[model samples]
Target: MEKQFSGQNQKKLGLSQFVQAIEASRTLAITTKVTELRRQGKTIIDLGAGEPDFPTPAPVCDAGIQAIRNGKTKYTHNAGILELREKIAAFVNKYGGQYQPEQILVSAGAKQSIFNALLAVCDPDDEVLVISPYWTSYPQQVKMARATPVFLQASERDHYKVTAEQLSKAITPKTKLLMFNSPSNPTGATYTKDELAAIADVVAQHDIYLLSDEIYMQLVYDGLEPVSMAMFPQIRSQLILVNGLSKSHAMTGWRVGYLAAELPIVKAAAKVQSHSTSNITSISQYAAVAAFELAETELQKMRTTFAERRDFVTQRLRSMPGVSLSLPQGAFYVYPNFSQYFGKKYQQKTLNAALDIADFLIDAAGVAVVPGEAFGSNENIRISYANSMENLAIAMDQIEVALKKLQ
Candidate 1:
């Protein structure tokens, strides 16, 4: 009976082999688990996810409401409405780059924008070079495209910024694209203009595209300006810039992200968007337009608050024994080195890997932090400081108490 049922199902329905290939990807699964635990009435203070805790600004919400009342619910264009594309092009041009509306493709979110770029450029057996301690999704997305992910290991010693020499050594004939994320997730490392220029010079020698994920560009701290790869004319032809209102305007639920590239690449990405997810919400596009037009003041307020939070959290981590951290120049995250406690025992239990430490923190301290292993490092942990000051203070105090029991 079992063999007959299996045979019938196997003949009628077949799952794609690629579906099984992605089972081990960690971000979505772990985040969902944490959310479920919280839903079950656990006292969980999640420092794991990378979303801002702020609400979308009132003006942006008002714009979306108005758009809905004015009958803007129907899909306008597959690539995005022309008005939004023009706004995006103008926004990109503000950063010393030339982009037309024809060169923009808006999608559901920055994640989808990245997926479109990778799918458009990658072929089977190609290599996608990613700098480590990167966002956890890069390698997964590369593998989904049937491309191999090559890690150029960056570390806390160098502030987690990959060097030109490192990238040069990693590139080969199979290398088709390099994924670069500044104000990086899990590590909070940002590259300077000079560093980007150096990397761009080497990429110019090879036939490689640079997928620059600049979602965190608006969150830079300490008077630092965010640099885009489009600023370099030498590598302009090979750069695809991805950004969105999800991070910058706290519009995560609204799901408005856009990619800026050459016309050919934009056309390819738009076709992918049309077939997969056609046109981000019409109301959301209006919301994004209002966000880009009128939320500059609110954006600055959010930036100031995040900078203070980053300072407070880094200071608290530094005060802990055997914990070391670099002052993240951008992004609202603190990636602290806790390698010294790996082999130590806490409460009769020996700590071994970062997952052990994460579990300990959650169970004993009531705080949730993502292990660096998920970001290609086992010696550190990422704590997002996007929560309120009071919560952050309490969480850090609890973390300190929990660490003292370790050794």
Candidate 2:
């Protein structure tokens, strides 16, 4: 039986309408569904989330617990603990950028740091240029800020890189920021220094800001050195580099990420964070300090393992009949081009979209992968190999069999 709402109650609930763009956006939906299915006893192999499958390193967790025991749970400085700000400044400086403690704004996660940057920099009706295959949140966050997100498609033929020539074409007077992610989430593409310098030259000449999300910088593979946009002298004035301990230290649940920028941008981000989700978690801030100060050896081990998995998964994807993947220098995803599978039939149902292929894999192959639509592509899908070797092997086997079944 359904409970009926009173007329007055109905009117109250309907007063605030949801904006359609915000309501329709989804990428976390698949991960939530997979978790729900597992809770109901279904054996699902999830490659849908961009999270690590490893536990947070022991030392970081211990520090958090110790902070609580030592009664350090009070509210912290709005910008973050001074020590953390200093540590972050030092870390950012090592990347060939100059940063003072005043230029660091700590937020709940790297996701929030990105939002803070958009909020601080973009205005209503302003244009923000984002390259294709972006993190799903960029457009949605821009919409929430009442800004327009302009997308430029980066083709796989060019290794999915956005050239300075292409960027010059995308810019207009209204373009306030140009956003790109190296070691991108879904495609795992890392831009070369020369490529970045070229793009930086374009943005620098235009008087626009460059938003570089380097959250996966530490996970780079096969001798690829990830370069920061701030390293370019011309771009440093307008660059906001977002990074966190999430992937590098396996500290996703800790919710510690910081934005490194000039003093004005950082101050604005801190002010916004103050009224929204202030200070992050006091205990987690302490843990983050340890994450930044710890030795590099353990982190290197994680990177080595991810590199092996990347190679393994890329080779497996290539073996599939119609699937093709480019080798990525960083991140643990293989975005396989599956346009050849479109217009075919699977169980008498026509496959038309990347979402369709993803659903087929999950429902028929028992493997969960993110659709390319989540990353602004309709001809591809992302496969994450952050699981155990045995599980990744089994999932790949099932995926190949499932693709062959499509007519």
Candidate 3:
């Protein structure tokens, strides 16, 4: 017999199939473990974090405080406040996006902007091309939108950059979008203009949208300038460029991000957001305005610091025996192939996957890194250099010493 509606006899409501299919974030799991260890009075050097270790620039903080003083705490327009949108338009224009205030949608973060764009464009049977060694959220978000994430796996030999040929071959009739990231997360593989142009030529031939995630464009090093898919006029109608202040301005807690696209796409994303998060915090929007107005000198200081750390981490990793990675040009993480040590054993547990490497590091060296499996690869683990040099040096030294102990 069917169960009657009673708290005692009622069957448990099951979780959504869609959500059940999504994998829990391994990075967040590692973060939780690190937090617990710290709570237990353990000293853990966490290189797993994706956010900047730098504090938010002072003027930006002042802007938020000023916003509060002005009582500007009401819900903003769904597309964002006009002033912030205008400033964002100017910034987007500099990156080759000919966007107007009406063409932008500011969401909770670049993440939400991407999610909104995915929901706006992807149908149930649609396929989204994701680059492997990807940001952890890409495939999960695609799946959450009921779209299949088809990976275009780039080889470490290619510096983890997807080629035009690979992209051309990956596109099918069901392909609805391509998620392109430059100065990529986890790998820090930034593509050059020539590579981008060749990729653009392929996308131009297809009836697909390009959701370009350039959140780390401002953090590039090695005399590298930022390039954008918006720079390609051929795909302008099909382009959705997402950027946020979280990474660039050390405003992760502030939750401000935006997308620049065609008017219809922006309108659709606004519709999606209106049902979910509406606008981001009004205070943060005002602060984001000041974020754009931040002095170049302030940004340069952080960039220079990150560049030094990147160099230090790169040199350290390359010097380790059996460790190798392409020199990362941007972003703050170094992903070194630790697959060479996969079969090595610790006390009793055998190292097998990237997750094992991450776990073993925490136990052996008190170092916490995000496993490469979190980013759709298991041959390596991601070590973010978004920490102070002193901490970074200590972490690297501990890591090297710990590696020698594995047999």
TM-scores of the models, in the given order?
0.95, 0.95, 0.97
TM-score of 3: 0.97
State which candidate has the highest TM-score.
Answer: 3
Number of backbone collisions per candidate: 0, 0, 0
- CA lDDT, every prediction? 0.87, 0.87, 0.92
Residue 221 shift from truth in candidate 2, angstroms: 1.1
Our tally of clashes for model 1 stands at: 0
Q: Which ten residues in a row have the lowest lDDT in candidate 2?
A: 7-16
Which digits, one per residue and each the tens of the lDDT, describe model 1 over residues 1-407? 44333322254455556755664655555577678888999878888778899998999999999999999999779988899999999988888679999899999999899999999999998999989888888988899878989999987889988888888889999999999988888777878888889988988888999999989888898888877787888878999999898887888899999899999999998888888889999999999889889757789999999999998999899999999997797777888988888888877788887777887888889888888888888888889898999999999999999888777
Rank by TM-score, highest first. 3, 2, 1
lDDT of 2 by residue, 73-141 (tens): 999998889999899889888887898888899999998999999999889979999899888888888
Stretches of candidate 3 exceeding 4 Å from the true structure: 1-12
Who is ahead in lDDT, 2 or 3? 3
Write one digit per residue (lDDT tens) for candidate 3, span 15-113.
556667899887788889999999999999999999999999999999999999999999889889999999999998998889889999999999999
Minimal lDDT window, size 10, model 1: 3-12
